[model samples]
Target: MAAFDELDPLSGRKVLVENNLTFHDVTEAVAAPIEIPNARWWGFFIVSVMMLGLLLVSLGWLFWEGVGIWGLNNPVDWGWAIVNFVFWVGIGHAGTLISAVLFLFRQKWRTSINRAAEAMTIFAVICALLFPTVHTGRPWFIYWPLPIPNQMGMWPNFRSPLLWDVFAVSTYFTVSLLFWYVGLIPDLATMRDRAKTTTRKIAYGIFSLGWRGSTRHWQHYEKAYLILAGLATPLVLSVHTIVSFDFAVSQLPGWHTTIFPPYFVAGAIFSGFGMVLTLLVPLRSWFKLENLVTIKHLENMAKIILVTGTMVGYAYGMEFFIAWYSGNPYEQFAFANRAFGDYWWAYWIMISCNVISPQLFWFKAIRRSPLLLFIISIFVNIGMWFERFVITVTSLHHDFLPSSWDYYSPTFWDMTTLIGSFGLFFTLFCLFVRFLPTIAMAEVKSVMPQADPHFGEDGHHE
Candidate 1:
């Protein structure tokens, strides 16, 4: 086809994909990673397993001794475990937002990143679920949170916010898993048809569900995907809303606030997109995917980070405003103490990273620079974790009675457990990239110029 650099007055310039690639080129590019094993992948996978091992060891010791191994104090009953839980849960929000919410709205840019983002969502949620179970100090009794009929007449209290977490997160994970799986079927069929080995053939064939790419198959797939997308869009809002309830419903001075729902939701999408940048930038280089992912996709995500980060900063200021406006001494002290008191260091870190760093994305160069975007994204992840820590630890460090107040500090075990959760997340992600097509091959093809019926109009094509 002849080169066409035509521009529409309305949208300026747009390129969801670069490099003038055809359908076969997209397939070869995406399938290269799975077809040829890389040494870098093995190294990444090994380190992840080591981290997973540490998590296992930490949990084993926790089960043997108790939750007392954590740095819990008189005033601070909840510690890093709860903070990590919230952090991981927030890290999962962007996946569903990109895949389900954006898909429903017909955002074409999501085609490149949505598959990997969905996998990240599943892994992050798995890491999030671990903390609540272990935090109870009895892994064996973890099932007590479920309603099981028994002669003792004991059942989970549905009224508890923690129980609501159980329901909300599980439902989010289930719907996300199904949605991700459904999207993968067409691509899995591609992998199945190309598999050379019996093991690969069997694995891909089973997961592909005998997809033949016929007219009937495409019809069912589109209808099913649309239905699942509709089902998943509400969950993007509801899951985080329920999570915020864990703090908002509390009577504690710092924790009691009405702004928590929207604030937490915005922060979740903010942090989740941060993580997507952090993971995708390096892989984009390692896998030679810059053309496919393109500067446009990265910039769009950066724009989102800037927008949500601003909302989060607004919430921060709003919290202080609400405290002062409420005329409650306890609420005022909580806000003041968080900013200027004992845990002041953590609070400022959250502000500088979450609020300040994302502002740099407002610049055209920084938003388009993959390296700079990666750095800021790292800062976003750190700031978001600190945000959760501040929300959890600062509020509990000093309660109503000063006599029972104390400074909260994490133990070595706390450090290990937190790092190990990263291990689990990366381990699953490494496996995903190795075995499956990280980019959605079919979706990417659909967005190409050759897929358009008007490609040869005016004899533009050779």
Candidate 2:
């Protein structure tokens, strides 16, 4: 072995010994020209158009008539709208967490997934914001939820959970969108350079904001990014915590639990990872991004899903144990009713989808297989929806009074709105895919072995 002084600092080639074998770092892995199956992009485009049309139609209907056209009523007034709101907000968490938290941890592997994940974060937050405002019944007076001057001398209820949600969600969206657009600047410059038409070049050039890859610019850029990521890390945690408070702060038997804050955070990550997997697994293959985003990245993501799913399962177990131990009859009965009551099917579906489905990832074969991961991701999504349903409707349907007890199922309008939300999500995503870089070229380049001269042989110096 060469002594430290004898070795070149410029070529600090350190061998990675894994599984009793040595490996050398090579040139940066350049993403090959993507030759994705034509059908995939076309299919996504078609589906997005259809969904966009549906979303416009639904929004028009909701705007024209009012919230009353839906099934919301007294006692059950916080119906599917709030559930969908929380669900979409939860879905938003994983993106920022992956981008900010993982970046702080110096997880170099995050390069492939972080770009698209951040975009999803922005779009998911947009989907989430629609609910509470529209659910207000008087959609025009949605500003009443904000801290603003009004005709009345009254201030909005500062103590209200919904009020906290308004602040938290808005703050979260602002920060997330900022972080995402900041990251996109370099990539947008790349698109601007590669543009073939005057329109495309001008559009991308403006968005790129005259980025020139200057060392000084990068110095400030990196500093700004670090500060933004630091801000986002805490905000990501707080956003979902406040969302959970919308339920936990309530006196409802099933909703009232101390574990909800962290439990909601974990579930948010779980479901958000599920959505990421659903989008990426298809996208990587469809876009022929195999060299850019390899199987190792997918496997790592699967591992996270497995870990979060287990935590979710443990939370479920704790809720049951605590309900019984608290000696509160209402709490115990609520949990018991969840497992084996009229809506027991929804409860079991939640358990099976969230808990059982993720277990398949323990098998390396399943985790590595894109198709299998895609299927599991869908199951996780379904399970998460039911998890919200089990928490909201199950708790609200049969409350403290037996006389007020009633079964709740979504009406046609409710289903239409739900479907339209999917359309909205996909519509935004499709637009992003067509226009945006999709991959973080600058970030990916930074992580490449070639970027670090110490890792390659040719850069050797004494």
Candidate 3:
């Protein structure tokens, strides 16, 4: 075999595998957390559980008190709940973008981070799903949106974008889950074989689905994975596009723009990457996975954030331009009020966080610093939340009629419920980190230079 040594053209860094890690090393590194539990992990898990409990309490109170507990009223009918929904949904877009979109483009860098990002996508969707369900007020009757037969003879309005959301989000979640699980089979088998205890072996074996890693098995696995990736690539765009439709289909001035689809999709990916960085930075540091999840990977993600951030900024500008160009007074007033009205602070916050902060990534130094990347990512998350808030609340607060305009604010329950959603997200994430391989071991190994047959042990090209 020939051993080829090359440099990474982008970073001018050596492509040699650091520490000469092997396939066994990759498996052991990923499986270590499952085998040995740590105090930090438990501490984080406990906190997440406590937060989840808070969500449960808040939800229970909301059910008992009704939707009146929130800051919803005449003009501002949809409040923090819808805002949170859109925010979480947008945050889910990055996972499929990295996993399916990049994979289709033959991007190798995704191997190290795709597993956790896909898990984050599923968790984010779960949080997003909570908002619409709870907002129904009588959440138990949420099945009303389904086409289930009923004695009362009530069928869901298929034309409504709200119903469209039910289909879009559910389909996105199912496809993402299947893709993630399919990728885990080989790694799960590795875990099963390495397990010392019968309980662990049995559990992993069941999840592994009798994976033997034979040549025939791999051929089928590759085909299935590729097919799923093809299916998921469109979902990365379509899911968010349909979500934007929930607003665009409305008669509201600010909500009715055609730009909402592409704009929302970009913002979703932007926020999704930010969240991925927020979760991964601390995770890699805590687990000492810097070698695997290197600065290069973080930098690449930062570049994406910068590009998408710019697109979001452009979309923001175009909305204002369109408002004026349309010669529609309601649209003009809505856009003006969004930037200079009662919720002006929120608009600027969204601008600063989503548009301005990511510009720092243009500097290689900033992108290379984990602490800076983490901080900027947090800003992106906060900014994206405010973006939804500004869109949902500001548009509703000021309608065409001056008499109906009213200020809206979240109630105590609203604040708690939002916090609780974070708890639910983290709780699931912590559990995932503990039980499953946080990194795709097989994929990571495949990208390693040692896996290349053309690379010889003598460190020379064939």
Candidate 4:
């Protein structure tokens, strides 16, 4: 390992040079000062504490009072709970998508945000799990959905979308956590070195698994990460497609469309990118990482959002066109009634937020502006929620019989539970930011132009 002592051509000054540092150097740099405070931190703590209390209270009530207290009835049995489940799960997709897919593409910007984004993925999956787990009424017996034979000799339905969701989501969460944690090991080792207290050192030491910055370790680590990324790309698409199948597999008129898979995948990426932007924009600024993360990273993400948004819009059009072409009066009536019927307001909001609002990003100015990007990200989340609502409630509310048609609304408990999920999300994210290296510093440093000084000989960097 040699230091570059040559004069610089760009600035005509001596280049600052040192022994070439490994990934360990970069990881330590980012993890060293990660404990800074922002207003969002206090807000996150307060909100999370309150939400935790609410979650405890709500769980107690659900157990004591029974599932009857929920707004679910025969026709609309799957209401706010299911909607929020899909919403949060969709939120979970953004993180792994940003980390794994972008890694595969060699997108350098992903390094700045992927660590936190992947952590968010894990937390969002946790929140998503609560819905189905608790909503089962007999939460304990929920395991009957697994393949194990019970005393009654009944097995879980392999054909059921619910079962598919169980396998898909569970596998997705497990793999994503593994990928995220594996990526964090080298960084955790860096933290261990910088740990102020024995406790911190021990904790990070255990997490780091005694990682040493040997060339052999880096070789194995890089290979493992690439394989994990390959595993995750399909998992990302499969999880959401299975989620869509939870609707599409049903015989319900509006829900029976074949276009749901691609549509749902696009919407997942759209919403996922939105959630990533929402987290990173404030995070980069608050952490004083302007030079490291950079505006160009956010701009790249906005372009992704734009592409995904357009795909969602195309899906919407395809759904409409196919509904008309299918010649099923039930399907036709379902789409029409969704737009112009009782829940028309919800439908329009979905359109405006998801389909219309994102089109503004076509302008480079809006795409690059952090403030506008933040606002659009919020819109994307809102629109995604409405998209799930429109798919679930709208289709189910108006089935074949006119008499069975009804409206769905979130009750008091429903509202609390949804908000409480947000608390859970932020709490996990805030803890991750405070404790772990928020940026994948090793990966970022690897891509920086100055990381390799051989550029003068090969002229590859210029």
Off by over 4 Å in 2: 1-39, 455-462
Put down candidate 1 lDDT per residue, 139-237, tens digits, no spaces.
Answer: 888888788997789988899887998999999999999999988999999999989999999999999999988988889888998888898889879
Displacement of residue 70 (Cα, Å) in model 3 is 0.8
Q: By lDDT, is 2 or 3 better?
A: 3
Best by lDDT: 1
Candidate 4 deviant stretches above 4 angstroms: 1-29, 36-40, 458-462
Candidate 2 lDDT score relative to the true structure: 0.82
TM-score-superior candidate, 1 or 3: 1
lDDT, model 4: 0.83
In candidate 2, position 181 carries an lDDT of 92
Against the correct fold, how does model 4 do in TM-score?
0.92
lDDT of each: 0.91, 0.82, 0.91, 0.83
Q: Report the C-alpha lDDT of model 2 over 347-370, residue by residue, as the tens digit.
A: 999999999999999998888788
Candidate 3 lDDT at 129 equals 94
* Model 1 score (lDDT): 0.91
Weakest lDDT window of 10 consecutive positions for candidate 2? 18-27
lDDT of 2 at 424: 85
Candidate 4's error at 372, in angstroms? 1.0
Return the clash pairs for model 4, or none. Answer: none
* All candidates: TM-score: 0.96, 0.91, 0.96, 0.92
Give the Cα RMSD of candidate 4.
Answer: 5.0
